[model samples]
Target: MTKTRRIPFVVANWKINKLQSEIAEFLDNVNSKVPSQTVVETGIAAQDLFLADMVRATQDSPIHIVAENVHWEDAGAYTGETSPRALKDIGATYVLIGHFERRKFFNENDSTVNLKVMAALRNGLRPIIDVDEDMSKYAQFMDAEPSVAQVASALAGVSVDQIRNITIAYEPTWAIGSGEAATSEQAQKAAHLIRQTLAKLYSPVIAEQVRILYGGSVTPDNASALLQQPDIDGVLVGTAALDPVKFLELINIAKQPSMPGQFDTDEV
Candidate 1:
């Protein structure tokens, strides 16, 4: 990809960890120490209860606030669930759907995830869809590697417009929180498959424009190597993102150059 074509994003999934006070402090540190905007597009996915505070904290900054999960209904009796409309009303721009933890604990199936994706789009919020990573289950159900093709098929019931508005995050479930990460080769292979699947589902143009992020045990020490992969457009951080200093360091590392011929445009 050309320099002008690069779409680098760094997303922090706060999960259900921080308290309101901790959220304020984290926002303050991120606002005060974040590097120049040219480096990467930054976003934070906070818990539902803290979405308002996060939105308030990032008002005048480039940082975008995102919710970790949202329900398909606009407003309903679904207790303990966040409404997509409410999230949009509070200035949230993105919602993470089908994360590993959500699928594992809440029993979120692909159909439900598809509904949430549609709801996010209807409310004018972008959906960052995490393709479920149960490789063992996937192997039992399919013959080929679960690429973007499978993801597209799962959401085939939706229209092409919704597909365009979505960003695919390729997080291998096994690597998450295991202090292990996909090798550059492994990441490239998966990301390339994602893009290829998009090309087949829609068009090459959309595939080229779509952003694919890597998430799983990512840290400052290993970010540069991962970003060097031509297909790896950005990263979705977890535990490391909890600390301001370490998060900033990971951003800086993502800006460094990789091995010489690794990113040649011709390779794409």
Candidate 2:
């Protein structure tokens, strides 16, 4: 069966930033301006303290409330950890797992990422799994081992049916928060490699059905080129997303249809 085209997903990862008032203002500025989820899906990953409020604020909007992180266990005594169940119950529909920063600073590894992915699925939260790659490996994607290996490991016990809900993000560790973004060609190569990895893990048809995003210093200025990549379904934005106007601009760029010659149905 021919699958429907993947909807562009523009997610803002507000890592440890934004106060309550700021959050409200950001929402107020973008809520009605955001395109419909059907046209271009939008999400905001913020601090746990603000998720419920965000959900409430976007209740009439199509913007999905996203959690920055989630704990593996649904109900656990892991103090300070945000349970997946709690996140779902509080109205968060998506959660970022194994973000490069989390793996680098909080000791989040393949094992923990896998646990959280499954946990989020069990509790009805979509997992936007972030896989960071080295620029050297990304250049010669055929030898890109760590990123592919991380994808395989993260979905270790995930069933084929559950895979449909997964959205893999390719964020090069070197470019994140550095004000340097990868060239569009480089980003496309990385996203294609990730899709190829998905094909190997499941099937080409299933792989084509999956959504892959590129992160690391994505901005309105660079987004059009990046979004033109056939394999790049959307962007996991950072610094630039903090500004509502820029965020809306990025979404508007995504709203534009893919350019001619960008094959959406190319076989894996």
Candidate 3:
């Protein structure tokens, strides 16, 4: 592509799906079939209950494990919440926060997401913060504009080098689970806005270093074109990730060399 320093990442968010038994089988499939030294980095974000088992299964492989969500505190009486320390202890390299389901069903807000991100960083875990472009669904219960702006602001001020350890997922709520994918142009436009927002809040250097991903109904068939977009560093795949062959195919596509006119013509 543009010869960027950051590697391409493919994250599978198996939200509330996959049993422990299934996870073990999936790990085996991944270990045996994964590419040796491709440009793409593979990762899976499983349910909180399966984090330990998943990590143990993928310990020997280069595949990274991620927790679907975690609490802001290290340890306490948070009944249904996962501790960041526990996640790190289990060898989780990444944590996904502010997912669409969490924001829609669990009443999670920007402040809570910010705290969780800070806690994940403090525990030496990378945070993959998810931002949904379609906030119309939450407009009545929450303000779309300021809510998004608050999250952007939170990430901007959290750490000394926040963007370095953070990966952003721009999931347009309208496209999620609808079997419809955003056009390459649409995805690049939104992703560029996210980068611009970061640049405005932080410095241009940090914004350039930060990786922005496109999520929602990403499949093997569409991944190549999507990753070819200049602003799209990677993908946060959902249903397509459930199948081993499909998931690997997506990663393989991302690892392919960029073709002419695939990325931005303006970029060197």
Q: Model-by-model lDDT, in order?
A: 0.77, 0.88, 0.79
After superposition on all C-alphas, the RMSD of every candidate to the true structure, in Å, is 4.0, 2.5, 4.9
* Model 3 agreement with the true structure over 209-234: per-residue lDDT tens digits: 77789998899888877888887889
Candidate that scores best on lDDT: 2
Better of 2 and 3 by TM-score: 2
Stretches of candidate 3 off by over 4 Å are 1-4, 36-38, 135-151, 259-268
Off by over 4 Å in 2: 138-147, 259-268
Candidate 2 per-residue lDDT, tens place, 1-268, comes to 4436688899999998999999999999999999888788899999999999999999999999899999999896899999999998899999999999999999999999999999999999999999996545545656443247788899999888999899999998988999999999988888888888888888877788788899999999999989888889899999999999999999999888653212355433
Residue 250 accuracy (lDDT) in model 1: 77
lDDT-superior candidate, 1 or 3: 3
List the candidates ranked by TM-score, beginning with the highest: 2, 3, 1
lDDT of 1 by residue, 180-206 (tens): 998877777777777766766766666
**TM-score of the candidate numbered 1?**
0.86
Q: In model 2, state the lDDT of residue 79.
A: 96
Per-candidate TM-scores read 0.86, 0.94, 0.88
In order of listing, the candidates' clash counts read 0, 0, 0
